[model samples]
Target: MVYDKVIEIIKEEFDVDEVNENTLLREDLGTDSIGLLELVMAIEEEFDIEIEDANLDDIKTVKDVVDSIEKIKG
Candidate 1:
C-alpha cells in the first residue's frame, strides 16, 4: 500500500517510531516549519512528483499526505 511506504518515509524524516493516518504534524509529531518543508521534499523524491507549494499549507495529517500522493499518482 502507498501508506506503508509513506509511513516509512514519514517515520524516517520525522525521526518518529511510528505514524498512522490520523497522526497530526504539530500535535502528534511536533513538526516545525522547517521540518514540514523537509517532509514535502522527501515525499516528492519518494514519489517522483512535484507538489504545489500552496498545497503544502493544506497538509495537516499523515492521511492528507497519503491522499495527496494517491491523487497525484492517479
Candidate 2:
C-alpha cells in the first residue's frame, strides 16, 4: 500500500512513467536536489508522516523511501 502510493507520488512528482524498487532517485529517476526535496515534501504530505532531515541522506532508491515511511509510521 505504501509502496504503491509512493510509486504514484514519484510518478506524479517526477513525471516519469517507469519506476521500481531499485530505481535510484538521482541516476535512474533524474531527480535533482530540488526535485528530491520536492519529492520528500510530496511524500510527507501524501503519507501524513514526518521524515527527519537526517534520514534524507539514506534515501537513495524507491525501496529506501518505502522503508523510511514504514519505519516512521511504526
Candidate 3:
C-alpha cells in the first residue's frame, strides 16, 4: 500500500530510526525543498502516480503525504 511505501521512502531518504503516521516532514525529518522534491519523485515512481503542484503546498507531514498518495491512487 501507499502508506507502507511512504514510510519506506521516508525512512530511506532521511535515514530515520523510526517513522509513524504523525511524523512531520519538515519538523521531524528536517527535509528541505530539494528533499521534498526527491521524496515526491520517489513516491511518483513507486506508486506510478503524479502529484499536482497545487497539492504540494498542502502537504506538511508524513500523514499528509500518505493521504495525498492514496487520494491520487483512488
Candidate 4:
C-alpha cells in the first residue's frame, strides 16, 4: 500500500500513466534531475518524512523508491 501510494505521488507529479518496479525515474518516467528533486520534495511533504541525498543515490526505479520509503517507515 505504501508503494502504491508512492507511485501515485509520482504519477500525480509527472502525469504518468503507471509506474512499476522497472520504471526508471528518469528514462521511463521522463523525469529530469530537477523533476526528480521536486518529486522527492513532494514525497517528503506527502509522507512527512525526509529522504537523505545519499540514500537517494541508490534509487533508480519505482521499486527502489518504494523500498527506501519502507525502510524509512520501519
Query: What's the lDDT for all of these models?
Result: 0.90, 0.93, 0.88, 0.86
C-alpha lDDT of residue 64 in model 3: 96
Taking all chains together, each candidate's TM-score versus the true structure is 0.93, 0.96, 0.93, 0.90
Ordering by lDDT: 2, 1, 3, 4
Model 4 regions more than 4 Å off: none
Task: Give one digit per residue, the lDDT tens place, for model 2 in 1-74.
Answer: 99999999999998899999999999998888889899999999988999988888899999999999999999
For model 1, the superposed segments whose C-alpha errors exceed 4 Å read: none
Report how far off residue 38 is in candidate 1 (Å).
Answer: 0.4
State the lDDT at 39 in candidate 3: 91
Instruction: Tell me, by lDDT, which candidate is best.
Output: 2
Index of the highest-TM-score prediction: 2
Q: Summarize candidate 3's per-residue lDDT along 1-74 as a digit string, tens digits.
A: 77788899889989997999999888888988889999999889988999987787888988999999888878
* Candidate 1 residue lDDT tens string, 1-74: 88999899989987899789999987899998888889989989989998888898889999999999999999
Q: Give Cα distance to truth, residue 32, candidate 3, Å.
A: 0.9
